[model samples]
Target: MRKKLKEKISEALSSVLPITVIVLLLSFTLAPMPIGTLLLFLLGAAMLIVGMGFFSLGADMAMMPIGEQMGRKLGGRWKLIAVAVICFLIGAMVTIAEPDLQVLARQVPAVPDAVIILAVAAGVGVFLVVSMLRTRFNLPLGPTLIALYTGVFLLSIFVPNAFLAVAFDSGGVTTGPITVPFLMALGTGMASIKGRDEDNFGMVALCSVGPILAVMLLGLCYQSTEVSYTPFAIPSVFDSQDVGAQFLQGLPDYMKEVALGLLPIILFFAVFQLASIRLKRRAVIKIIVGIGYTYVGLVLFLTGANIGFMPAGYYLGTTLAALPQYWMLVPIGMVVGYFIVAAEPAVHVLNRQVEDVTSGAIPQKAIGLALSIGVAVSIGLAMLRVCLGIPIYYLLVPGYAVALLLTRCVPRIFTAIAFDSGGVASGPMTATFLLPLTMGACEALGRDILTDAFGVVAMVAMTPLITIQLLGLIYQRKIRRTRDVTQAEEREIEFVDEIIDYNEEVEL
Candidate 1:
């Protein structure tokens, strides 16, 4: 257990440190923020690292094992019903806990935070069950995604434009740090029971569709009012002490928010431990400790992104964007996007899970490369939208269409991980930094901010679908060629065996 803790802590730090370096460089070179703000940002980054370390450790200790164990035990009388109920609850709990969603929920006008959280949670629940069902009966991943997305597109025709981007953003945001690790492990663990490799891969893919439909339906329900929210600018104060104090005061609110978010998952796990599976007491205790880490990490993560990082990002973009050379938006935004995706707490968990799920055949580095490219493209496209004042649908519709089409060509598991990547990639950093930066750029360029600036998150969410699926297609083709070579070898061996047998018979 001690070794496990050390390893987890080391991994989290390693993951976050690179991003912190980039942030520091950005602060000094690009933003050149005040000393007070820089100090606050560094403090926030430290908290984020510590929080993430504890959180990932806790998740390893509790969430992944518990999910796998429960999934493995889900057999016998009323198992189907039982699995469905558990899936729904897990989906709801994790989605509610998503930090990115909480960020977006706060920004959304005329909607209670709870309302948006619940709506997104419910969406995740419904889709998770569908994912489980796909596992139970070998449903082809491509057709299912195509059908579901086709339905979503048809619905998009009448949905309010204001809600469209927000709705899609909800889909991506709901699958955050706590949710991604747990869901991927749960799906893989559940697949283990069937003893089928193909069954394991598509759970992430299938579950992604749930939020899209849910949010689109949500768009239909909430009459689209034009988004009127303008982000609050971070005031540049000379006093470092005051900046520290303001951050500390704001920290507790996020602590409370994350505490509430984690409660449902903990309670559900507890109930599962006692009533149904009856695991040993020691294991349960370990999981409980893990839950503590997850909660602490989540609280700190939110505080850093919102209080420290967000304002810095907004101010930086506003400053750089105001320059006469509007093209500065493209390169700076792209560089930031490249490093920023690595900072997202969920991306670490996602990459690790993908490697584990594929047994190193799909390397974490590969996943990172794919993500970097996708994010780069998304950032570029987002800047274009901001510059041209283009409607998000024009980009989103085509991107998703290509992504969904690729799902058919790629392997089943890749499809799941790819879709899941979409959600994982568009996490807190995207919201706090990328969104604000794009917004600032748009405001500077004199473009329509709502229609243009608002959909960067959506774009961030969409591009991964294409890149990961492209990865999947490449993997599938490789797998096929390998199989062909193996088959040829087997045939040659069989021919040799037959010749030997004939000679022995003739000699006899």
Candidate 2:
């Protein structure tokens, strides 16, 4: 347990530290924020990172195994009821736990957080059950997604303009680190009963569609006020003492905040531990220790991000855009997107699970490459959106069209992983680091952050759906070619044997 906890803390620090250094350099060199503000940002970043680490630990030690076991054990007699209940509970738990949802809720003036959270959670639960049914009966994921998303778009037309972006964002944000691993595991376990890889892997994609429709429907149901955001103001950092004091002062606040966020997830895990997993007392104790490490790691990460990294990111974007070499923004943005996705803790679990389910046929390297390309394109497009002040709808419409079309062509398993990939790829780092960086750049460029910066997460979530499905198509074609060659070889061997037998008989 101690070792596991240490590892989580180590991972959190290592992943977060590079961004912190980058932020510090940018803070001092570019925006030169006040020392107080710089420290606050650093503190927040640490807490965010540490919180993620602990949350991930809890998910693994408790949530994931429990979900998988539940899926595996549920009998045919109760499959429907078991699936519906689990999906609804997991979806609701995840939606409620999502920090991003909370952020979006605050942005919407008319819809209360409780209302939006419950509504979105309900949407996820319903869709999740639908997904489970699709896998159970061998339903095609592509057509189902197309039909569902069509409804989402139609409803989007009626939703208040103010709620459009936030609504879209809600879809992406609901599939965060804690929610993703457990949900994917649950889907895989459910799919495994059928012993079909395609069925197992595609559940994430189907589940992802549910939130988009849910949030869009929400937009129509709630008439939100026009959205607005204040850019992060540069802080003055004159000396080391100022940075130290700022971090010191903000530490307790973040500690409390992260603890609050982690409690529910932990409690959920505990309930599962007592009721489901039934690990020995010693094993449970070890898991408890792992949870503690996770907590420490999260605190460190969040504090670092909010205090040191975020301000620096904002300043860097502001300064870079201020440069005569504006094109520099694209390359830098792409690079950050590429690395940031790798650092999203949930991504590790996703990649590993993909590899395991595919028997190493779908290498983690492939998923990484696909995710990188998707993120790069998303960021590049986001920068363009910021520069042009283009409506997000222009890009999203084409993007979803391409994604949905690919869903039909790709193998079913790929579709599931791909859709889930979109959500996993856009996890916490994108929110804390990439969003702020883009927002700062947009601010410096005099662009509307709401129209531009706000949509990066949605874009990040969309592109993976297309890219991974493309990979799936390639895999499908390869399988066909291999099968054809094998058949031809067998025929040739049979023909040769007949000729040899006839020739030997004539000689005799």
Task: Provide backbone clash counts, one per model.
Answer: 3, 46
Top lDDT: which candidate number?
A: 1
TM-score of each: 0.89, 0.86
**Model 1 C-alpha lDDT per residue in residues 397-498, reported as the tens digit of each score:** 899899987876777777777777887888777877788778778777877676788778878988988998888888888889999999999999999999
lDDT of 2 by residue, 1-508 (tens): 4576567667766655665665666566645756566656666666656666675676567556655765665414454786578667766766676656677666665666687778877877787788778877788777887888887778877876666777677677777655677677777777768888766665566666666676666666655555665557655666777777767776797677556656665665566566655778886776666556555655665566566666667767777888887767887777667666766777777887889888999998898888988998888888777767888889898999999988767777788788888878887777777788889888889887777788888899998888888888888899999999999999999999999999999999
Query: For every candidate structure, what is the RMSD over all alpha carbons to the true structure, in angstroms?
Result: 3.2, 3.6
Prediction 1 TM-score vs. true? 0.89
Error of 2 at 134 (Å): 3.2
lDDT of 2 at 372: 81
